[model samples]
Target: MHLPPISLMLLQVLALHTLVFCCQASTFTDQTDKQALLEFQSNLSPNSRVSLASWNESFDLCNWTGVTCARKHKRVSGLNLSGMKLTGVISPSFLTSVSLSHNSFHGSIPPEVGKLFRLQHLNLSNNVLGGGIPLGLSNCSALLNNLEHEIPSELASLSSLVLLSLRRNALTGKLPASFGNLTSLERLDLAYNRMEGEIHEMLFLGGNAFKGQIPSSLANITSIREFDIAACDMTGSIPLSFGRLHNLEILGFSYNSLGSYSSRDLDFLGSLNNCTQLQHLGVGYNRLGGKMPHAISNLPNRLTYLFLGGNFISGSIPHDIGNLESLQTFKVEQSLLTGELPTSLGMLSRLGRLQLQSNMMSGEIPPSLGNLSMIAELLFYLLYPGLDYNMLHGSIPQELMEARSLVSLNVSYNNLTGDLPREVGKLENLIQLYVSHNQLSGHIPQTLGSCLSLEEISLNRNLFEGSIINIRDLRDLKLLDLSNNNLSGSIPGHLVNLSV
Candidate 1:
């Protein structure tokens, strides 16, 4: 049906009005976006090492460097001002707040960000940005922050923050105690930050450990602190260039196929002396062999943990082992080390755990060990000094019994002989005493009953004679292997807790 002439005129007028309104709105959005882009460039131009000379009003806003605009309305949709080598403060105002991540942008985040009333998303992650995290960011639902320096207690105010990923950074200082106040936070990552806390326990990689031998070029990354490449199933020697990594901390190469039985297998230890901050070295459970180089003694004095166990290491331990004053746990167990205990070991006043079990070490027990316990009574201390399964001979030194901190004493399967020191009773904390399969011959110390914490008492296959001394007070006793001993008296009735 045909409309009347006046109806047609009304329809035509309405269509023209809609077109003009859309054109005016589009022009406004375009001009606003262009102005915002120009403002952002002006703030960066003076400090930016890269050129933004192309950002000018003479050209279209869409064509300006790192600027993206909507095809329909010609309004800025994105601004990737990354890698501009920007050196000034972050721009306070921007038309879009999405995807400004992984740039070379430097400077403090502007606090004026809270002024963006219409803002929804903001991600300034993976940049050279340093300074306290901006407080205004608490308003966002998610964050991929890249901040350096110490974290401020003020960040606990971001109660609504969900994901805060700040991994692989140089952030230092203790974490603010107030972070527990983040009631709405879901995930928080602060890996690789040099703060005062345990960074990780075991970082098990889901995929194959190595692409191959770790690239020696990685040594060029002198700033790296950790090299925990254990269980990587990799072959070849560690790169000597690793010494160049002056900031290296924990270096782990355990459970791998590194090092031949060659003399130079552990030459890398010499180079590692340069890493003054080195601590917690673990090269255990590998195919590494040969005598430990004297360079091992030259390791950084800062070293606290040295795990050279489960290898084919032979020859006497370096005499200068005491040089590592901060040494805490020395585990060379299950190796082929021989020779007497280095008397200098008493110098490691801070030594806590000495595990030399399962080696070929011989010679009478060192008397200087008494000094370890004496100094321990002052400041540094030790516990669980395992020397089992060796060629260690002569009497159990009376001084060794003074290590009151000893909880477990295992000297089993050795040539150890002589009376069990009555001083053994002084180890009130002693739990398991395994002196079985040795030449030890004497009445089991009646004072052993004083160690109420005693659990497993394995004195079997020794020449211990007369009678089993009173151990009725050992209520926690579990395994009592006294077989093949010459004890003549009947077992006490109260010894019901122990399994024969």
Candidate 2:
């Protein structure tokens, strides 16, 4: 009941009015965002089947299905429309951590997607989406994860991104040079796309993918591993600087246009000796030539897999190859290698698979091969041009049959003689056998039929004389090739009962 001074009372009234306006303004902003999102929801195809009823004035966005609100309750944090069979362009007004994967969304990604400033994760994979990647995606400053198509150069602006998966899309165009700017990226997968051009040095983070001259500049990102740049048409020899990547492991350069390597070609490979952690090196189907580097035998002791198939590798396999104690897989198929297989190969105690098919390797199969008891299969395409040049003589070593772990053996097209070893039945896990086109004589080992697990057997072009016997033991046989042999009897009647 005491009256205040005029100026003071007016000031108080103005202060209250200001507070009310601020509250109204805040409410208006929230409603505007809601309306924008609702408008977007309405534009979606009826097939989308996403109901906006859950997104109303009373219900909190965090409580809505496929919607997540920020901790501050100031805005929606996430929006997932995956698997909705959506068939429309994305709405630009909706700014949320969005996921529209596994949908039918088609058309070019809208540049407006870049407006989602607070977005952290955006997944639009497994859709019929086409067109160049939107340059605006770089605007998502908080982006930590992205699975989009047609990767945009603007994406390099996202300094906070961590994981990016862009696989299995029709994306084309060279990878933007700005990709090197994504310093925080970890799991980058761009497989099964049309990305071309040599990887820039900036993108080659040592142990990480990006073949060619090893990006000496990126050698500092030692945390990188599992680098894959396969099927990218990359040419030129591997950079020797890669050896600087001490923590590097699992490098893949398959299905590229790379040239054959020589001793000079292996300078990069030799440098890899410094990568003590290197494992699973794949350079298959490249043009790598020349005798393999002798130093290749001294690669990281931790090596478990080495694939150099489909190349022009010449010369004899280095005798020191046995030094790779940890090698589990060694493949040099389709090369021009000559001379006998090194007896030292027997020292590879951990070797599980050995493939030297389609090579010019000559001389008797080393008896030392029996040491590879862990070898599950041995594949070789024997090339014999008469008895003069490379006639692989001597009987098939009984020691080879001692490889009880052998599941499949392919030794076709050579001057191999003598009867098929009965010890072959000891391969309990044998599933496939190919001994065709050899001069092997005598009756086909009856014990071979005892291999119940055998799925296929190729004894064609051999002098396997004598009548066939019980084939019922080969219950699992899918195919049996006894054609071109000198066997004297009709096909065994019991073979009629097999699934083959």
Candidate 3:
């Protein structure tokens, strides 16, 4: 009823042949993967406690220890050889190769493990290897692992590593000079270690105690995007070679003695014009000098914070500073800068804080400064303040007081000689005003009373000759100094009932 006898018999024979072929392929894969697992366990150096006794033909390959097989192909897809007193693991990928990263093993990386040509990713980070490793890999993380002694030059052979995070280790000795050979390296994090020498990258070596100048060789890595080496105790000038890094975005050199206060100390800043993507530049508190670079005006408009304060910088702020439209903070106090405030500063509509105090600047306060329309989102920020402790003269610009976002104003210790503008009342959030030691005259504006948030007022050493205005509405007033002035009135009634 089905088919002819010979035809049916041939069809059955073909079906049986296909079944045998499929079984043979499956058995071949299992034996190969089983042998690979056994090889994996045998390669682990020292007396590894990785309980891999079950990785045998007696057990199913899919059910072997730390071995994971795919649901359909049933091929060895992952291996988590952790808790072997070691620090490596594996994962799935194409080429069907395996990986090893982030585990709790405690042996030196065995040469046998590296011999596996099919291995893909290997991250043996955070292993408490109580003994010694054959070599400390320089281009990968031994982070928080207490790996000691000098990093040998032989470890630089791992040229394929992209991120080498060796932070928070006790690894001592000078950084190996052979590190420059690793051309594939991008980010080198050597922070909080005792490694010496000065190399940079995305470069989180901020807390180390290296004793040399930052090597100019770092500039060869033009692909760098962020380079931060702050507080590393490295003296000497920043290499001008750094300018070659056209892709630099965030450069931080703060809290280090990096400059000599020479006339050209800060020339590196101008050299950064090619780094069009730069956003945050913090070079404050170094011994850097030279005039504020005119190229600063040409800095990327994307620049947000520029902190060059607490240095030996001289000359004037760049007149084209307003070009940094995205600038939020401009701090250059405690420098040797002179000359008048540039009118272009007022064009920084996004500027929220300006610190130019303790300079030798002269001339009248630029009236254009009031044009700064500080963003209203912040609850506290010194808006266009800190023009104090200079040789500035002339009256407080009424325009300056018009910046409604100003929270604190300090023009004291200058040679200014004008009546405080009544527009000050427009600063409803004003908390403090210091206009002391000036030649300001005329009745203190009653509008000052409208600023109910006033907490401190230092109008002393001025020529103000009238009674204190009725600031009874200023419930937050804490300190009021009107001394050395020619005022002939009693203390304001606002303070009369207070327990000062």
Candidate 4:
């Protein structure tokens, strides 16, 4: 065992060098991960705008564009190739975060993606990816997509999932009840899909072919604010439980077959009274019929827009509709409505647009309507208010001219007997005036010439006496029809010369 001190020192130095070499060898290059990334790059078509030329065997995987590695293990941790115009099937990699959104990437997302057990975020949105989402992605927290397949129920296992958007895709199949397991989810948009089944939360599934009844389970999503399932093939009355959504603000169920022509069909309107925050309600173009429910007037005062047109709804519009202090637009045209227009509508000081044409409403235009100083657009023509259609008898209300902001006035095809209001010229902003096909008798209002903004004037088929006095002054008139009136005298020479 006896040895020179220098020999012993040399052995110690050798031992130290061995340990250093072992440590360096243990920190080997992640060749498997690197090769996987290279394979993904190879699958995409070559794009002049997006070159992954730096992804090669010569360069460290961490140094590749769109690649990031963990600090300690130096393993690929994230891959963000968003908006790169990369086109190809997505290849799986052991990444924690993967975002290839807004690209031209097409083809099915490989099931191999599910192998990323550590994946926290995955976004393939705005791509043309087709095929089912793999169940293996249950570990992800944020799952966004542009996928065309059934939403896998396995997604319910992602307890940490918060945001899921599969909009503008051809996704089919029903929403799985297991989705209730995602307690942390805040926003879910599956619009423009072919998915069926009930919805929950702030759901937006418009422009989809979703069928079946809107589930009453939706009441459980008390936190929901916006629910839009319009343009779907849903049937059955709107769930009365919807009233429980006190926070709901916008509700759209238009263009769906949700009800039949019965009083019970609109029973849901009573439930909505609890939704104090409700502002917009659209249920037009359905099979809904029955008297306009008085419960509609009980809707939230914050309601600003109400559309109930294109339905079989009968009876008079609820006079209490004027209670909607915030009402801005009210559309009830093309329905089986009867009775006269409600004069209380004048109370809607904020009213801007009103559509009540194509109904069985008779009687003279309400003079109270003139109180609508805020009215900017009005459509009540195509059926004379006092002519052949509804048997309305009265003079045209001069009060209407008080609405200085009025841009359009339509009251044609009625059986009214009176002269046109001379104050009609007071509507300085009037661009269109339709009072044709009536039984009115009198000279054309001379003051009508003051409406310089008039672009269209229809006064044909009326029992008017005297010549068209103001016809010569409407220089901006693009259309003028004053024929069939009992007027006498030669046409004004200036009127014939105008470019109408």
Candidate 5:
């Protein structure tokens, strides 16, 4: 078709313009977002291994390292620079998920981080980040850090928060009562902080300076499963209201000043029996005194670890304690406990570590303890089936020698009278044997030399008659005290030349 020259020229120009516009659209990138990232890179210390050399105006930010962008808008969506040895200030950006954990980022978290209204997950954990947590993180579903400073009450606004961990920080001051407003909160860990004052449920504030009674308000959080406030300065009795937490599994309030020698001090044990699922209960290293209530036997049968040690608890350990069929660790050392060792303790098939040391316990060592075939890791490899410092007077139970896991045995300073058990040599794992200051009579058992692992043997001040025999093979022996015994013979040449 014939057309004018002007019309042909106009059509050609229109085609050229369309080509140029499409090229520009294809190369379009969010310059603002790119600039923000560049600014962030500038704040970090230079590292040849993890440089942001690709983050420049010449390239698209979506193609940069540790950065993600939306397909349509090209805005930053995620930034994961974790474990890159990043050392710098974290510049605020409009991101959905930000993870700078396991880095070397230092200094206070900028409050401008709250400006990311779309932020859902933020993790700055395992970093050197310091200062208070920004109040602006209320929109985050998961916020973790090593932040120092009081827990901001503004966090109560984080209704979407499911996990908040600020462990190993210097956070101090009381938790605001507004924390109760966080009904959606599932896990809150503020451990190893300097936090003081009361606390509620879903709290793991162990290794803190928190003092005063465990707040009764904790009973309101019925969904709480694990609660630990150990190694704190908290005083006063455990609240009776704790019984309401029927779902509680692990409860630790150790190393505190929570009780005295009064009966009312341990009444909480009776209340705790209501928690049927209770498993691990550690109230050790406290001022808990008075007779251990028999109700302790009624604690949920699911209990595995029971640490009530380092207290002033007196009187007999309840015979019914054997009812805890699931029991693993039973530690109650350094107390004023009296009465015979309960034979019922042997019924605990899962019993591993049984510590009843430094007490005034009388009577013979229960032979049934040998029935604990499952006993392993005894007292952390220093098993002191302590009948020591007591009036216990009987032969060392041959049954105890059945425990092949026995490492250290301390029957020292007792009124025990008998020949050393020949079966003692069967304990190849025996490291230290302390039967000194006892009325043990009979020639030192030649079988003792079979203990290849023996490092220290304290048979001093006993009626050991015969000269030590065959101990020359114990090259690991460092300390051997057979002094003040009825031994009349030339010292073995090996013993005289021994290093110790």
Candidate 6:
């Protein structure tokens, strides 16, 4: 409290100045952010302008539309203006990374977007933005940019990319062979587009609509997990090298035109025995023929679903199929397979659905099928609901009734003779009943009315002779086709609503 000299007073004045300067510096940063917000708002629609302005306070940018700030106040960290009905082309000068996916940004992706060097994720999916992908994207150095445009060779520069989703766009042209340059990519989705060109070696197009021959090089991407090129118009042979993809889990090449070099080209399928991690393998709707490779039985116990339907595959189904104990859905419909149904099929303890229709399968319906119940609680559903076609001669085995969990029972278009099993009505969950186009039948079982969940019942073109009884009690029936059956009785007046 002593009165000091003028020198002491000068020192106190300097300390006050330092404090004021620090406050002013903070205020300046806030002002700068406000100015940027004003610029961004001016480019928006009147509705958007008002919405953004309400959240763009001078001291807080986090409240602004699609914006996320870091720990420090008012510093722009993440901007997500996606699906905002924004009409203008992206202005890279205003921000770093931007997302206009599923919006109305209808012009070409501005090349200026590449100028934002800090961009990490740019998603422009589900938009009308056209024109070739800007090669300047490489300048951003981030790997997660959307490639809704054609694959640009300049993308090789995004060596840090980890995920790229460009699916469901109008992108075309071949993938740049240099795609492996993005060595850090883990997931790539190019599905549901017109992307063509041979895949390069050591590359993965997981969840993409890539067409043309699968590149032998893809076998080198040992780390790929979910590889899907489904419905991509792909043709030519499946590469034998695919067996080397030890880490692949979900491999789908369905709905394509893939054909083998010759009838015995199934040798390539044997190579897949090494893909121990594969769980879902779909190569349906192709022209591959010959016996299924025995090595296919070597697939790991983890393998569950196997679809080889709609192909030209011939030969008897190998008993080794039982080795796929975890199989839940096994379909080989519309193929040229010939031979008796293997008794070993009973070993599929977990099989829920088995489709082997429209093939030259002979011999009786194996009693071994009854073994399905001895193994596990069956979640199986057999679907053969359709108009009469083809001939499958066999007795309706009572052994099938043991599958207590059966939800659908269709044995139509076959040569058979047997009385309606009263146990069939025990399937309380049966939704479809197709037993038409067969020989022999007794009185229509009134017990069938107990099948409360039946949605469809087709018993036409058969030699069933009896008055349809309690037809009105089948209340759940939506479509009932019983034409051309030998029945001596007047039409059930209450069944008018049952015919479809």
In angstroms, how far off is 232's CA in candidate 6? 5.3
Tens digit per residue, CA lDDT, model 1, 113-196:
654544456667666666666665545543444566776667678766555655666666765656656644434555445555
**Model 1: how far is 381 from its true place, Å?**
4.7
Best by lDDT: 5
Return the number of clashes found in candidate 1. 0
lDDT of each: 0.71, 0.66, 0.71, 0.75, 0.77, 0.66
* lDDT, candidate 4, 1-500, per-residue tens: 11112233333332343343335455335675675576566667666125788888788788988999878878667889888877666655556688888887666666655654556787777777776777666555443455667888888887766667677777888777787776556556677878876564336688876777777877777766777889988888888999998888889999999897887887889999999999999999998878889998989999988999888888887888889978877888788888887888888877777877777888778898777774333432211111124445687888877888777777777777788889987877888888887888888889999999999988999988887685666779999888998889887788768987
Which residue runs of candidate 1 sit more than 4 Å off their true CA positions? Answer: 1-208, 375-382, 497-500
Query: TM-scores, in order shown?
Result: 0.61, 0.73, 0.68, 0.69, 0.80, 0.78
- What is the TM-score (0 to 1) of candidate 5? 0.80
RMSD of 6: 10.5
Backbone clash count for every predicted candidate, in the order shown: 0, 6, 9, 8, 0, 7
**Candidate order by decreasing lDDT:** 5, 4, 3, 1, 6, 2
Q: For model 1, name the residue pairs that clash.
A: none
Winner on TM-score between 3 and 5 is 5
lDDT of 5 by residue, 41-115 (tens): 766777722566777767667888889877766666788888787776665655667888888776766665665
lDDT of 3 by residue, 1-500 (tens): 11111233333332343344344455345555565456445445434424566766688988877777867877665666544553222211121233343445444443223323334444555565433334533333334465677767676787776667667777777777676766666667777777766553224577777666777878887766777777778689987887888777888888899899898888887778778888889888999988778989988888988999899988888788888988888999888989999999888877888998899999999998887745433434447578889999988888887688788889889998878898888998788899999999998898998998889999999999888788777788888888998888677665787433
Off by over 4 Å in 5: 1-44, 51-84, 92-98, 139-146, 197-203, 374-384, 473-475, 495-500
lDDT of 6 at 418: 71
